[model samples]
Target: MWFRNLLVYRLTQDISFDAERLEAALAGKPARPCASQELTTYGFVAPFGKGEDAPLVHASQDFLLIAARKEERLLPSSVVKDALKEKVEEIETAQMRKVYKKEREQLKDEIIQAFLPRAFIRRSQTFAAIAPKLGLILVNSASTRRAEDLLSTLREALGSLPVRPLSVKVAPSATLTDWVKAQQAAPDFTVLDECELRDTHEDGGVVRCKRQDLTSDEIQLHLSTGKQVTQLALAWQDKLSFVLDDKLVIKRLRFEDLLTEQAEQDGGDDALAQQDASFTLMMLTFSEFLPALFEALGGEEIPQGI
Candidate 1:
């Protein structure tokens, strides 16, 4: 919690790619031009330049977050509006739906870049942000100790507004691998042990989950510093499904898919350090998961691999 010298942000990655060709397609441009750049133009920037060899890596930009001693109490909204006008869509910009649909994230990035550079003018010892679009307000020392006060005030100021309020968050500057591992093995890991498997007609052969809003032990185990995860469910369509903190949904996955994503997010393929979505999903399917759970519950075993 020593935030005096630290800076934190919870900025959503913005759209930093071209949408003109896609717009042209929507405007009845030739098929060849549109078809050629289908997936190519939708390229994503690799995190930390890991996939430099991949051709589509051209679509991404390295994150621009920085730690600075805040100098202003309030950011000038006029400044933000002038800079981010292009990012927001109105009736005029709505004509070419493809531009907005395809490049939504890119537009978000531009909006952040246009944010006013200020945090708070109030001397109540609460952290704030100039704009929610830019980075998160991670920590403020001369601020209040109540995290909810800081978050609630910010949300109240902007939640009802058309524009999203800039958020304030606190997180360690660790590698993604460490972050995933910590999440997977947190002390509140009851969700990993208590899972429900019901026979289903779905491709995965069954449904397994614990209700997030049940107001029970199962739901409480996986709660984060915030209710980051509202639900965690798994589905199999020759692949697995995962939703984390109600925000990160990993679907259309296979056994290898989990590891692949883990490798990408964790920044290492140690295999042993598999995170929850992939690790827990692997246990739910390939491991002797069903039988063990039934036995643990003091019920007749459902049969191995059930």
Candidate 2:
């Protein structure tokens, strides 16, 4: 359960549900398959897709993952529209009269219904975890819409989930630009070899650099042209390396050397043991990283039960 991208949010209110309570709530509305007429369906499911009927909410000691599963039919709009048009034309030709707009729309709906049953079904799962101790919800998806969809599913299951985008008092662009200018990293962070610089104004341009020295003259030229650092590659205390964006989403996260060490220690066998060790390692690391990140971004403490 490694996460490549992070869509993070701050839980405005405390969630104090024990494992049993959360499981019961999720069971009340489990994931169901998409019906013939339904285009899409969403609900909770197993985090790792383990077991026949995996628990709706996978709860560990410090973390709980609420897995959201969505099944959608692959019915192309143009295909349906073309088929409807052809059918409408056949009917109009038979009667020797042009079909009205309302009738054409009705035919379109009918065609969709007729084809819905034969449409291919696509399934997707997105996982989001709640660290109540940290008062944060971390989504594994990079897409904001997907993350919001998962949050909406959680809201339906739990009745309510008060959350907001994590905000920091300091301007990320300013801090990042300063770091690049000084050719140094922020406190507790080490600047890496990738970054994205963009203009702060509307319709501004962007420059992306990978595996290039950020302190080079070319990057300095962009900075001189009022292009602020919107994203930066950073290594946090040598444990985690990722691209931290202006939006505060961490992408391309790499747990340096941990996986290698784990594999070597386990002799690269026993998949289950490896999974457990990796999960434990990630949980331990993030428990420290999250709060430290929040502090580095000039975030204030969120009072309990707010």
Candidate 3:
């Protein structure tokens, strides 16, 4: 599956487990349904839904895909408080006395406990790739908090999944602005039609442009006034297009062209073959693109002894 956004991280320590051992460990941590009165359950799961027969870890040589699932009961605090208030009012009316504040809070907890079991359950899945080969983990998300949730769950399963956010030598805003001003690309990248520039002020201003000349004198004027490029859209060769943000995250990725060319080259009519081909193409392309992109952003420098 293609990732729409990337939350890139670098592994801080060596991953000792090989594919087989990793798979077995993940199988031992397969996701379980939320129990009654349980707020949430977190664990690993089969990426492609093969159930017990399916390997919890999907390995493609050195690249591994770990799918994490979180099932949570949708019991809103407001709903519980309202129900508790109703119960408190009912008690007051029956006994013809006002309920104490502490007693009301106790009733609130009781209402929440009684409501959780029957609350509707919502399940969410986050798929992250472990490329111990490259010492990297790429989670398909733009939100750092959500990515951290996945990483934390993985850490609990593996006992020590030490990773840090991918860091770059140069600030992305400075690099992107220089690229636009010089009208030169970073290695294999080409400037696309979208960009976002922001003023370097406390109440900073923002400028977003689409389908406009990035190197035009008008755009350059903003750069002259200290408005740095916070986000720049670029295409990596003909394979991928995405916006590079200041936080080193890639967003709004489009792989339609790559997928179409791959589908035609593979010449597959069968659904299963097509699926396999898509995965193959993604693995081949991303393995190359990630390193290049990292270099373009000034390369990664992970800390020692994490």
Return the TM-score for each candidate structure.
0.17, 0.89, 0.88
Return the lDDT, model 3, position 235. Answer: 92
Clashes of each: 18, 0, 0
lDDT per residue as tens, model 1, 51-98 = 324221111121111111112244455755555455455533777543
Q: Write the per-residue lDDT of candidate 3 for residues 45-66, one digit (tens) a residue.
A: 8875565787777776567777
Instruction: Provide the global lDDT of candidate 1 against the true structure.
Output: 0.30
Measured with C-alpha atoms, the lDDT of residue 101 in candidate 1 is 49
* Full ranking by TM-score: 2, 3, 1
Residue 219 miss distance in model 1 (angstroms): 12
- Best of the two (1, 3) by TM-score: 3
Superior candidate under lDDT, 1 versus 3: 3
TM-score of 2: 0.89
Better of 1 and 2 by lDDT: 2
> Which pairs clash inside model 2?
none
C-alpha local distance difference test of each model: 0.30, 0.81, 0.83
All models, RMSD in angstroms: 22.1, 2.6, 2.5
Error of 1 at 58 (Å): 3.2
Span of ten consecutive residues with least summed lDDT in model 3: 271-280
